[model samples]
Target: QWDKPLTSKVTSYLEDAKEFVPFKLKEVESAELINKNNIKTVEWVEAASDEEEALPDTSHRQEVTITFIDNSMLSGTLVSDTPRELSRLSDCLNTKESFIHITNGERHIHVNKNMLLRVTGS
Candidate 1:
């Protein structure tokens, strides 16, 4: 009878559904899995070349006033023969700090090494 075959098909469908339940539970447990000891550790590395080139020595020593765009001034001894770099500006003026002050009439402002105008003998 057609009714007998329909009942057999429904029974096989329930058996397949039962097999899928364990697979769904395994997927949920796998999603919650964690491993704590797999973290990466970093180590510090030293440079291969430790020696650097020495700076050039200069003899033209004189007091120089550097003026910024805002008319601030800085007076310091100027040493030539050194390369014109931002970091070397402090050493060229023989100053320990990064900035210097220059005066423009009644107002005074701070200037960096790149604002130099001329170097005259003190």
Candidate 2:
């Protein structure tokens, strides 16, 4: 009996199914609003560890030429004796206000604690 075809009942069943599933656009808009505010904050916290590992090690000292914004140059062995002094000098070099350019010119280079000692050594 269930397998028998019913042409009159088919139309009524299709109409009822269509009425039950209604489209709501407001739900999609609310979801987008919530995601936009929360995603950036989550990404920033996740990236913090990678940022710390990328930092350079300034414990070891090396010879570098210090170039002032005025175009003057100073060549000396970078004194990394203390962490504070090394940090201060590194900040100065990294800044656009004062910079360091490493090079060897005809003039002799010198390294001193308080002053720059440069001579041709004639």
Candidate 3:
């Protein structure tokens, strides 16, 4: 029951929003309140794509493992297409948004940069 179109990307939905948002968990079968600080990583298994034009040009895909303050790890692929995101993964991580979006095949993960202690590439 979101106001936005189904085609909108999760990254876009999270951008410029409030500190907390409603997130549905299929495993638990309920929507939970998610704050930027509390969320270490939001992962989507077999994630679907939105509109192609809304997505990055995606010339490169690199695998990255992120470690949080609590020592939890979530590994996913980081895609870079634009010039700003092209130079390095850190550049992409430095976006205005608090979440860093990464993908691997059908898997997509958004890591909270603020909660991350380190990010290693593989």
Find the candidate with the highest TM-score and give its number: 3
TM-score of the candidate numbered 2?
Answer: 0.21
How many clashes in candidate 2?
Answer: 0
For this target, which candidate reaches the highest lDDT against the unseen true structure?
3
Which 10 consecutive positions of candidate 3 have the poorest summed lDDT? 47-56
Could you tell me the TM-score of candidate 3?
0.67
Screening candidate 3 with a backbone cut-off below 3 angstroms (N, C-alpha, C), the clashing residue pairs are none
Candidate ranking (TM-score, best to worst)? 3, 1, 2
Per-candidate Cα lDDT values, in order, are: 0.36, 0.31, 0.67
Residues 8-105, candidate 2: write the lDDT tens digits: 12323222323332323675743222321111111011143333332135543456654433445555444232355545554534432111212232
Query: Which residue segments of model 1 deviate by more than 4 Å?
Result: 1-58, 82-121
Query: Where does candidate 2 stray beyond 4 Å?
Result: 1-60, 83-122
| Predicted candidate 1 versus true structure: per-residue lDDT over 30-68, tens digit per residue | 543222122111112223331131112433333556554
lDDT of 3: 0.67
